[model samples]
Target: MTTTQSSISSTSPTPTVPSGSGRVANIVLDSFTEAGRHVRIIPRNIEVLIFATIQPVMFVLLFSFVFGGSIQVPGYPDYDQYLMPGIFAQTVVFGSVFTSVGLAEDLSKGLIDRLRSLPIVQSSVLIGRTLSDLVRNIITFIAMLAVAFVLGFRFEGSLTSAAAATALLLLFSYGLSWVQALIGLSVGSVEAANSAGFLWMFPMTFVSSAFIDTRNLQYAWLRTVADVNPFTQVTNAARALYNGTDPGDAVMWSLVWSIGLVVVFAAIATRKFKTSSE
Candidate 1:
């Protein structure tokens, strides 16, 4: 018996893994695995992201080339400079519908719930979706930037300012993406998500100081609302960042609003993520 025990112990394989304290390590690994899956699946559906770019380009070309020749912005001799930033904001803002539709589809298909059942971090699913949306936004933004450059849009800011502007624009996009994700989770179908996302654009972008300056808005209430609109704030910040027009409150306000939006929508998304039967 003693000889047998010694031989068994000697022949035993060396322990390959250290004893973990608990399931935390497994959970984290699973979380990242799930996130990777989400990313992979999203980009595969290139059709959805391709759709996000169509409207942005249409608006840019129609407004910039057509109306831009006639309409002029004060202080900025070239209309392109004044229009480009607002155009970027408009494009990014409206592009958020993809997130809504994607989320709604995932929920309706029981994909999100299946993910939840896995031994992974709860927030991983949302994080993955948000990250995937960010990737789509980056692609769309790059496409728009390239088109704008071809159309003679130029930036007056230093390289640092350009970088900051890009980051800020993406942050705003991310925040809006989260909000849309929440909307998607609540909606009945992807079609509803798509329509509802665009429904807000008329009021949010048109009513704001997008196409015209707040000072020129004749209606007192509309002017006030435009001046205070977060879309306006984001556009102004992008304008300032692009034109190198001194760092000011617009940038600060834009950041504040973006952060606030992410916080609020993220909370709601998390709850829905936890409770979703889908």
Candidate 2:
């Protein structure tokens, strides 16, 4: 019994995370490994992936076909160009919901417990999840771009500017994924996460410049809200880049907002994750 007690004490503690440079290396490697695990299995779950891509495509078609005829904004003769960037922003922002739902699902399946049992950085699991979801968002974005081109959407900007716009959207979405991570860790079930995660999405997206110019909004308060929304900064910046127009403060503000969201929410989510694991 004494020998057994001594042996147990001599063994490393559960989830024996490393220290100093070793810990940093472990986090980087473990995060990529977890991301790979999620990404690799994506092929087997083709239907979920297909539907996720399809929703944005449908939105593009519906807005371009039904609403394109009547919606006219000053300076934009073809509404498709003005419309495409908003759709891209809205879709990717909505895509962050996947991170929350996925995490909640993993928790329900005891995957979180399994991850905790291993000698890896606990926070790496969250990082990996957000990274994998970002991958899926990239795939979805590419598909939407192809469809947008078919709908006569043209980027008047240089290819480099267009690429910059795409990067900005992805960066914003990546930041939102961290916010979802916190929600997922806080929620008890996948259903709860889904419900809670999307509750703010519609207001956040539609109230902004996603569909039309916030300048056209008649209500001053509503316009103010849309103008101040972080999503508005992202959408406006993307729109300006795609149209080869100056983004003014929008681009800088978008980067600032995205980076801020990532920094703030990643810290909160990491703390919540550690607490939940304990």
Candidate 3:
């Protein structure tokens, strides 16, 4: 019995996972799994749902009922139809900001360091943050859909197309989260990270083809910019899914953007994290 107690007491504490090959995959999976377990503990889940649902719902009604009749798209039947998909893309895409803010908060509170010491997978920090946010965004998407239905926005596409649209949106959101995660790691300050994450969305969402068609713009340059914006691709993809319009090249563009962001930002964020650790 004494020898057994000594053996138990001699056991070493778990070591923090070391960064190396396949570290990222392990980190991301672990973080994602841990985040999933704590979903109910996060107040942000409710906040995200409310924000995602209410804002889009209001925009849908405001545009469709108030101004929809006044504005018309040449190839579209009505304004609400054009506006609904845009709102989905705009609202969900903006969710990337939360990824950074959450990471910043974790770092600021030293929760990241604690996790780092827990024998976790090396890339777990970045992966966890990205995957967790992806799950949250999915919830937000569902809530937004509920709101959309209540406001009379209907999907005209096959269920398969709609499911494909959701998958694409989630993929794009995950890729964007990697960039946001890097921003959080670099800033290492919750307030600054939050501001940086959100500030870009203003120009990205408002100045594009989200609410108004580019053709209606008085400025040729503004029209040109909106026409080429990556965001327009996402909205167009969503529109295709909603109205049964052929996804065309917009889906391709969306996929390119998502994959590109993941590669670029994951590399940057991982580098920053390693540098910070060293």
Candidate 4:
């Protein structure tokens, strides 16, 4: 019996993993798992799905029919074409509020605490939340585009240019999601996060070239501010690309702004998350 026990012990196999590689794998797996949880929730909430689909559709219709006649672009015959990119930018930017509200709700409900207690990677929650929000924004973008198409919005640019424009808008929204995540982590409640999320966006969008040409503004100061606004750069880039016009330096500036936002906000959010966990 002693010989048998010794033989069994000696033959036992031990598992080994490279710590760095293992951690990376865990983070990837955990993030995707968390993202799947959020994605599943969308289908279960019928009202949320309905509202998400309807709101952008409403925006496209209302803006195209009600305001199209009155609003004029210097070189365009169809205002709908001019209007679609603005609506696209607006809708996607507003979609980031969901991230803030969602994270705030999770924090308030003690879900963050629960997650902290788990063995998963610490950054997975933020990564997953941002990714899920990006997916939601994509859906919203598609719905809005379809509605815009029915309203006579067409892409005058090559399909590749239109696709690139869409990608830029999504990248901008992704960066904004990180910003919202930081806001969500900072705020005490979902209500505060919701209010805070839209507060900045209103001024930014209105003051930019999203709805109109910056040159058309009555005040020189307003035009100057709009000209320098990051939102203005993004909208102008999208408009130029969609209309097959020379995108010029707008695209480069928009890319830089988006990348900068992602880096700064992501670092802040990750630090806050670690602090909260402790």
How close is every model to the real structure, measured as TM-score? 0.85, 0.92, 0.86, 0.90
Error in Å for residue 48 of model 1: 3.2
User: Which predicted model would earn the best TM-score?
Assistant: 2
Full candidate order by TM-score, most accurate first: 2, 4, 3, 1
Candidate 3, residues 1-278, lDDT tens digits: the string is: 33444565356876455564575566566777667754654554576567656776777778778888788887777677778778778777778887888888888888878877777665767776777778777877887788777777778898889888878778877887898988888785889998999888878777777788778889998888888887877777878887888989989998999899999988888888867878
| Candidate 1 residue runs with Cα over 4 Å from true position | 1-35, 41-43
What is the alpha-carbon RMSD of candidate 3 to the true structure?
4.1
Number of colliding residue pairs in model 4:
0
Question: lDDT for each of the candidates?
Answer: 0.79, 0.92, 0.78, 0.88
All predictions: root-mean-square deviation over Cα?
7.2, 5.1, 4.1, 6.1
Clashing pairs in 4: none
lDDT of 1: 0.79
Better of 3 and 4 by lDDT: 4
Per-residue alpha-carbon lDDT of model 2 for 173-232, expressed as tens digits? 999999999999889999999999999999999999988988999999999999999999
Better of 1 and 4 by lDDT: 4
Question: What stretches of model 2 exceed 4 Å from their correct place?
Answer: 1-21
Q: TM-score winner between 1 and 4, please give it.
A: 4
lDDT of 3: 0.78
